[model samples]
Target: MEKQLRKQVTALALYQIIGGILGILLTLWVMFRGELVLTQQVLRFSLFAAALFMFSILCGRMLFRNPPRGLVLSLLHQVLQVVYFTFGEYGFQYVAGLRIGFGFDMVGSWTFKFRVALSSFQFDFGNATGQKFIGINLVALFLIFWIERLLEQGKR
Candidate 1:
């Protein structure tokens, strides 16, 4: 169990570090392209991603210390991720409107207006392709919980 916990923590930390570096590079590219407006958006999104990554790391640490409590924290983290992505996508489609060129049809004017009112975080939700992306994340969370349970059983 301790070994598994250590592995999970290391993996998670590495994931966050790599993601943060990539996000910084992408933001810098946008800035260099002379797209100040897009640059600002990207910067905001990057900051939000950083914050989320930090939260995940904190949760990972807590999970490492206590499996049951960690499982609950992980569940909450997944739920928060879903809400964040949903609203973030909605913001891009509705709030930013056609200005962002997300390569997809709008979700209608009324829905757009409603979403704009909800939040200001914008992200390309894969141009409204489907719920597959979110589904995969949820599934991964479930699998993590299952694996933790199995590991706990082995310890017992």
Candidate 2:
């Protein structure tokens, strides 16, 4: 049980690092492209998001020497992530009538189907930037999985 827990914690840390790196790269990409299509608030928030994820990576790296220490540190990381995601979604939905694109569409698809007269319909942004973000996230998650596999192998 202890060994398994350690592995899980390590995997979580690896995922955090990979995710943070992707976010940072996205921010840099936006910076170089010289686009002001989004509000300044949005850009600042994106930087905050990247920093938040990096903090998780730092926490994991700092605590890895002791299993118990790492477990405690990781729990704090989890709590911060949960709080951030919850508040972030709430704020986005309150301001933009949506929390992450496709959210409304996904909910509508699940709750009601084939409704031609539903009074409201969700349309995807279908923007190139959004597609780029999706691609980056996908790659980051793949890297996280690869890192987990390597860590698992090392454990054995």
Indicate which candidate wins on TM-score.
2
Question: Over the full model, what C-alpha lDDT does candidate 2 score relative to the true structure?
Answer: 0.41
86-139 in candidate 2: lDDT tens per residue?
Answer: 121232111101111221223224322221110111112322222111101122
Q: Scored by CA lDDT, what does every candidate get?
A: 0.43, 0.41
lDDT for each residue of candidate 1 in 14-52, tens digit (9 for 90 to 100)? 443443344444445655677566556566675765555
- Provide the TM-score for each candidate, comma-separated: 0.41, 0.44
Error of 2 at 3 (Å): 3.5
- By lDDT, the best candidate is 1
- Lowest lDDT 10-mer window, candidate 1? 93-102
Q: Mark the regions of model 1 whose C-alpha exceeds 4 Å error after superposition.
A: 1-42, 82-141, 144-156
Clashes of 1: 0
